[model samples]
Target: MSHFSGIWIPIITPFDGGAIDHGALHGLVRQYVEAGVSGFVALGTTGEPAALNEQEQGAVLDTILSAAAGLPVVAGVGGNHVESVLERISLLNHKPIAGILVAAPYYVRPAQVGIVDYFKAVADQSRVPVILYDIPARTGVHLELDTLLELAGHERIVAVKDCGGSLDKSLSLILDGRLQVLCGEDLDMFGALCAGAHGAISASAHLMPERFVAMAKALEEGRLSTARQLWHSLVPIVHAAFAEPNPGPIKAALSQCGRIRNELRAPMTAASDDLAARWTLILNKVVGSPAGLEQS
Candidate 1:
């Protein structure tokens, strides 16, 4: 199996009123690839897959896969409906995607056995490799380590984006040559690295790809202190992006840098004015000269 290491970005989709903005999406893809990103995760949590219609998901997958060139594209969202999820797997199987990033069912709250069966069913049908997504904080259900180990033994199950936010649980899975764990939390990145994770599926890389890449390299090279310092500098940005709903602070920062417009779908709102202002202040404190900030 091919390796998936380094900084993989969970990209946020750019939308122009319920429709995928191909231009903006393509531009972001090119920009990220140029910025030294190792892989692309289109339609993941950051991409707002829940908000996207099937047609939009297909379109974004096509555009992102084509734009990503040879870099790996992890087409996201296997959705909740088992039938729908299987259908998504079929579609992704035919695409140029390197793997499928499947999050747990939101609001359904299935049992552990159900969770295991859900992935097994999808993996049985999936043509490409499957990267199990375990972001319990978001999905309200955690794919227990035993379930993951069982699924990892499957023929097509390849890797995972471990967002459970538990280093202990993540570590347990990685011990004894289990699944390859890609640290899923932004703030705990350095810690995850210390705990033996392969790499990260980081959302912050959308804003600072090259730097995140450098940190990964630094850690790989045994420059622990250097990597920690770089990781520390990003805490403010991380805190800000998460202070509000995700892509909100990120979109605001992206717009401030001119990557995308500060627009979000309903049920998802923009950052409060006071929060936006705080993000600006935080950016100024860390960014110094808008060096990494995008401008129109």
Candidate 2:
């Protein structure tokens, strides 16, 4: 079966003492695995891949792989330099990961053709299946529909993390059905699933993962009402997740749950006090009462 389906957490990298806290990282992985996440996306945007050096990134991936406890894990490999990315993939090729999640080259904003060639090069070199990440907002270029459909034809390019921001294109890909579509945008997950996208690789799942799992299961099981109810409840928390930059708000929420420290690397500050207060309030309402946060 395709390993990319269902609610997968692009886990936040826990920090303590200005380093990647492996202890906190392990605990977080175990928490998600027990919470019933389908798998994990290590070193993805939510994990702050840009903030971590290469050695730190590898260590983080290794830690997550060890703690995943048999759950499938996909590693994120992204950058504007093809050679550098290829070297990274070459190293990752030796790992026991399920797949690699790669994005279009950032900043350079390559053309659609360049985008296609870039992904093709990565897929050609990657030993595992490739899950294309189409987050143009960060990557600075969109993988046009033709580019995506073309990439789908490649045997190694098995799926896509759909964050290109076009409902029409998203629906087209779903209808084409060659590539499995996993929603990358937290807020769009329910709608994408309703439109027949396979599942989600959600950062927001780091908080209340079971709820996300239940919601996805409900949709697939044809329980529309149950899915809607769950989606509505999750909407507020999803808003809070992206309220600041990413990882910051998510780290804050996780900290409140005692899953990780409420810290982030340089240039990425902690969530504002106001945002934290708001998150606490929303978390309580959606997750449970005041006592539940402490207990959870």
Candidate 3:
């Protein structure tokens, strides 16, 4: 089966004047592709899928797929409603996507058994493979190791985006060698890669995708020193991206580079003046360098 195993950028949906900015979105996708990222994840958490209406979400994904230029794109399929989520997956199955990234049911925090059942059912109906998204911080429930092991038995349940925040669980999954373990925690990406993770589904990679790709390559080639150097430099930028609830800081940094307008939907405003200022310097240091990545 095809498995994802490199730096994948979960793109933030760029907005302008309360509408999806297709022009900017396409530009962002083309930029990342040229930067040598392994793949792309559209409508993921960082994309602010929650803020987008159903039609808008479909349009955004369509734009991303078109702009990706045949690169692998994983569509995020997640929701608390099982029937609705299944229907969504069914529709997505017809799309020319690499896989579907599904998170555990959020807010409801279903029991472990229910979690397993939910994934199995989704996997059963999905025409494409499934990349389990285990981000408990947003989902409010852990897809515990046991549950994952059970799901790993399924043919279509191929890989995982490990963001549950349990080091022990992460190590166990990596050691199991059944499911391809892709780190979802940006800050822990270097460590996870060192521990044999397949790759990362990184939001921060949206900034300097080549650096993230180079770091993954370094680790794969057993160039620990080189990977460590890249990781150290990326630490601050990753931290800054999350300083104000996600895409805000990311958009702010992108705006400074004239990539996007740094706008977000209601209830999710742009980054603070202070955080935007801080990201400017951080991005400047990371953007153009002898290390990796070109300034666009």
Q: Considering every candidate listed, which one attains the maximal TM-score?
A: 2
| lDDT tens per residue, model 3, 247-289 | 8888888887777887999788899999977876776676653
Question: Higher-TM-score candidate among 1 and 2?
Answer: 2
Model 1 has a clash total of 1
Worst 10 contiguous positions by lDDT, candidate 3: 287-296
For each candidate, give its TM-score against the true structure.
0.94, 0.97, 0.96
- In order, candidate lDDTs are 0.81, 0.90, 0.89
lDDT of 1 at 5: 80
For candidate 2, the per-residue lDDT at 118 reads 90
Query: Can you write out model 1's per-residue Cα lDDT over 47-95, one digit (the tens) per residue?
Result: 8887877887788888888888789998886557889878778777778
lDDT of 2 at 147: 95
Residue pairs with backbone overlap in model 1: 257-294
- lDDT string, candidate 2, 1-296, tens digits: 35578999998899997988999999889988988889999999999988999899999999999999999999999988899999999999999999999999999988898899999999999999999999989988889999999999888999999998999999999999999999988899999999999899988887788889999999999999999999888898899899999989999888887777899998899999999999879977776853465354
True-structure lDDT of candidate 1: 0.81
Error of 3 at 42 (Å): 0.8
Residue 23 lDDT, candidate 3, scale 0-100: 98
Clashing pairs in 3: none
